[model samples]
Target: MYVAVKGGEKAIDSAHDWMAEERRGDPDVAELSVPQIREQLSLAVNRVMAEGSLYDPDLAALAIKQARGDMIEAIFLIRAYRTTLPRFGASLPVETTEMACDRRISATFKDVPGGQVLGPTFDYTHRLLDFALEAEGLEAPEREAGEAAHPRMPRVTEFLNQEGLIQTEPRPDVDTAPRDLTREPLELPAGRPLRLQALSRGDEGFVLSMAYSTQRGYAKNHPFVGELRIGTVPVEVEIPELGFAVEVGEVVLTECETVNQFTGSKLEPAQFTRGYGLVFGQSERKAISMALVDRALRWKELGEDDKGAPAQDEEFVLYHCDNIQATGFLEHIKLPHYVDFQSELELVRRLRRETEGRVQQEAAE
Candidate 1:
């Protein structure tokens, strides 16, 4: 016999109270403002936006605050909020060639058309934590006046395309709309669009691990960062009544293009293949990882032999990539299973008694 545990509601309420108190640690200290998080923690905000598939920085900041700095939880909050909003219309695909690039680099070519602009990056920064940041009333560095005009930068892939060195993406039918993974159930044999969508919103750490595995010779494809660009692009929406697309807003995006080597098949000629990644903001790591994973998943389409790598398995990679889903299942273990445990305990005891009785009977015989 087992008594059902009670007071779950009360316990949950108390836990929430404690959590709230802890989240507001040291009342005497000034609370972190949403604007500060939005501006100062811009990278965190960008990650939340990228994973949540929502672009509102203010909302992302609020989600971060509500989540108490847990980025996955913040992404969950933003994703939940996004589901409630009404969809007005789909935006026309923004042209990345016309992007107002703040940062652009290529591993393939050092001397590109627009020149490499090493805009705000931590690539060369020492990993030392600045104690000066902890000091109160520290003045921010003064900004230099007069911004330089950004010329239209050509894509690095285009240069390779001139020589017919890389495989071209299949042109989709104009009438066919891309599948929405959120609204529709994910079916097997997913297309590039669906796979790319899943990867874009997938957990950064998960995708990073997959990419790292490939780099460690799990399924080495000889990847080269053809181009990585970060900038703002205009979003336009086609109004049915207006008969023309209108600029709705501008969104910051990080786009990565990866050039991968592929051996020639019996039917196809040897050529460099392309993997593309485009994310919500200045999320280069996620974008690069996404690109690598994208290429790995294209093994079948590219007529390459499946090397049984985790990154190459579309079903396995996409299914387990969501941190929220993983966390929920993992954390569910904390829930009470009193009845189930009691049954298991009784079963074990009965089995032990039966074994003892059988041994005694055999000894008597």
Candidate 2:
């Protein structure tokens, strides 16, 4: 007698065991410590925090290791971890003006109140791979000696304000309703707050590609980064008992401002147009891209002519984003669908009969 296929549960159990072993790698080699991953794989950790909307380096590292260096999987892990955690409460909006900046720069101005501080950037480094790193090279260069610290960093926007260049964004009062993307389904024509939230957790690669498209004449958006900043913002929570805002914790943020030159309309004279981007972590490229996209989407709000650009379309920008959402919808098509297959079969059978009849008539002729 023929034996039927077996080990459904057992096979799954064994596969999981094998996966765990594979993730850890060779038993002979020393296992990677969580702290080591956190310190060394900082960029991966940053990506996880940025995409996952969670900020725990150690956990991010663990997720990275488990994911076998897949940044998306690491993000998924962080997202899953975050979902399980209990929410204490929402903190008051961060005071970005009070941020103790680590790196502050502006492309718009040569001389601002706070001088440009280029801190810890790989932008200038050569793209060549070092052979020494093949064997886990030691004796890396130490941190560069910091020059004199600037007292206060006045925002590059402040200089624009002095010149009355761009429109001033109104600070939200406590009574202002925040449109929550998590609770409510995303609606068309997103406001700045909702758009910013989507962008912060968006796939870095996707945003980069879309931003690149804008530069390559797909959308004629000439964007120059007005300002890019990496710093910590103080997170305050209003203590009901104390009746005041108290500093609970802090988070690293990347803020970007893009200034686009706009020739004016009949009502107003020529003015320097603007875009704003703010995100978690120190992603300058992503932040800058977000700013440019933000400006493009604000065409209607600013009363500028809708050039029908992809970036200018509110529905296009808000809907076709977020890697997690994109990936899920895309991969879902791969799942089992016998019902669809039966429908396809019916269509194919009808087509085959029609084709045969046509072939027989042609043969007779």
- Each model's TM-score, in the order given? 0.95, 0.90
Across 204-280, the per-residue lDDT of candidate 2 in tens digits comes to: 88777667777876556688788788888888888899999998778888888888877777775677888888877
Q: 361 in model 2: Cα distance from truth in Å? A: 4.1
Where does candidate 2 have its weakest 10-residue lDDT segment?
1-10
The models' CA-based lDDT, in order, is 0.91, 0.79
Q: Summarize candidate 1's per-residue lDDT along 66-172 as a digit string, tens digits.
A: 89999999999998999999987789888999999999999999899999988889999999999988888878877566345678999999999898898877778
- Candidate 1 backbone clash number: 0
Report residue 351 deviation for candidate 2 (angstroms): 1.7
**Position 302, candidate 2: lDDT:** 67
* Candidate 2 Cα lDDT to native: 0.79
Name the weakest run of 10 consecutive residues (lDDT summed) in model 1.
1-10
